[model samples]
Target: MKLVKEVIARFPADAAILDPFSGTATTTLTAAERGNSALSFDINPFLIWLGNVKCRSYSVEHLACIQDDARLAIGRVPSLIKNDNWVPPLFNIERWWSAGTLQVLAALRAGLVEVFGEPTEDRTDGLAWVAFCRLVIETSAAAFNHVSMSFSSETTHHEVEHVTYLYLAILDAVLASGSAQLQGTGEVVEVDARAIPKMGRRFSLVVTSPPYPNRISYIRELRPYMYWMKFLKEAREAGEMDWKAIGGTWGIATSRLNEWGPNSKVLPEILTDTVGRIAESGGKNAPLMATYVHKYFYDMHLHLSSLPNVLEPGAELHYIVGNSSFFGNMVDTPAILAASMQMLGYSNTVSKIIRKRNCNKALFEYDVSASWPG
Candidate 1:
């Protein structure tokens, strides 16, 4: 958030901000709070919903009513869980949550749908839904500190008192955090970043953090939430969404591996060399990693090429990206992306290393800042 604010401060007071990969809408919310109109885009429906919920205006009366509705929903949980129709996708209820806990969650889900109705584009019910999602995670047996969702060996007892107390606390926090004045108008679009140019809208500033080229799949991390929210009804649907994401690895098919060729003219030589080394490693997963790295740059190339259409002359772009190490080979993602931007006619393209972390040695995060030629 500090970094977002710093970048936004560099632009003029009335500069329009665009975040093409607005993960949790942090960039959009920051821009709005600073009195700048902002537009955010994310391909994931759940993320888009979350972004909208964070940016939307809500009344204290509506929030209080939601709390009351949640309390009533908790009372009806036992009966709601008996239907057996609310099972999560690709999951056995007993594996992740206690049977009693799952029942309470099922009831909560049903109650939210009944009280809030289906989520609309305006997302009037989004706050209630987000609160419900928070309850689902906080009450579950999954270890919150872990990178992936894994059930803890020790069981968690979730009685009515515990569940309702936690739910209400979370509800209050969400409301309080969102109570600030939303100074600027904001919009979140569910679309691919590559297609932004086609929208034919121009912005003075673009701030985003694209997915790193690491093999970690965000789809896997988001599966539980997506299933609970009904954004994905089955495992196959989850896979489809993963395939559409920028740097996805979990659901990529073997046939699509060859679609992105071995070399990219726009990317830096360091990236090409890393892909070559990974491909030559001869490990079972080597080819897959190679293809993923190649495709990452290819997609960025297309995204950079299209930026000129939507960015005003002299528009500034700040991309927060990270480097990755796969099979002991480094892929300098920000450097490669900066190189691609320069190739696409962006001026003053430079990558500044912002922070370094000791992740399996050293991993660096960078701010790849550039400008469209005026």
Candidate 2:
């Protein structure tokens, strides 16, 4: 975020900043903090809701009103969970959590719904809903369940008694710390990036960290949240839910087998050729690798192609991307994405590696910088 802020500072514009692939709405919210008009897009509507609500502010007085309502709403939780027919039958309630913990969290969600009454347009209602949902992950009985960290295969978490109030309490601290950031409402539209032409011609500054190969797919990674919000089911039922639409291999594989990406006209063959070599070493996971490479390249291509049309010519585009390793072979995702941007007429100005605590996503979380050509 600091790096992004720096780039935007050099450009210096209060024009409509855009984050086309806005995941958590980091870019959009940051821009808003700087007083820039912002537009954020994401296929995941749940994230849009989170980002929108996070960037908005509520007063202590207003929160008190909502808190009172929250207490009343929490009272209905027992009945809600008792009637919850959809709470994964396959989930090993015994192995994953204790009955006590499950009841507590479930009750919390029910109480939250009772208080907020299903997230209306009012700012106070919106914040309460977001707060309640955020608490779900924090209070969960499972260890490291917040966004796919290392899982202990030997010891499974099953007791609902393992609930923690710290998650909600910490959330309260975070909300209070940045009380000012949560002032206004930002619109979140669940739509395709390719179809963005219908919305507007250009944006002020574009900032995004698109998906990287071997990294968890955004759709799959955030599936739990999406399911909670009721968007994923709707998409699946509407026939718009496919592998590619959800950042899966089927969509990506289809792209690679048929020339695709920002440099599709030039780099598709190269990517295909490289991926082919990596697949040749496959024993059991060969098919999986083939599919992964295909999807990664194709998705990256789409992002590169979609952005230029949505941003003002020469508008600064800050893309924080990195490479990936599959079966010990390196796929230069940042370079590939950069090349694709150039293929679509964006200039590669800067690409730098940021040294950070490397997590499970990739070997590195380097920042690859670029600018759209005027």
* Candidate whose lDDT is highest: 1
Q: How do the predictions measure up, each by TM-score?
A: 0.92, 0.78
Q: In candidate 1, what are the lDDT values of residues 65-147, reduced to their tens digit?
A: 77777667667655665656465754665767787777667767776677677555665757767877888878777774324
Best by TM-score: 1
TM-score for model 1?
0.92
The worst-scoring run of ten residues by lDDT in candidate 1 lies at 251-260
Residue 130 in model 1: lDDT:
80
Pairs in clash, predicted candidate 1? none
Clashes of each: 0, 20
Clashes of 1: 0
| Model 2 whole-model lDDT (C-alpha atoms) | 0.58
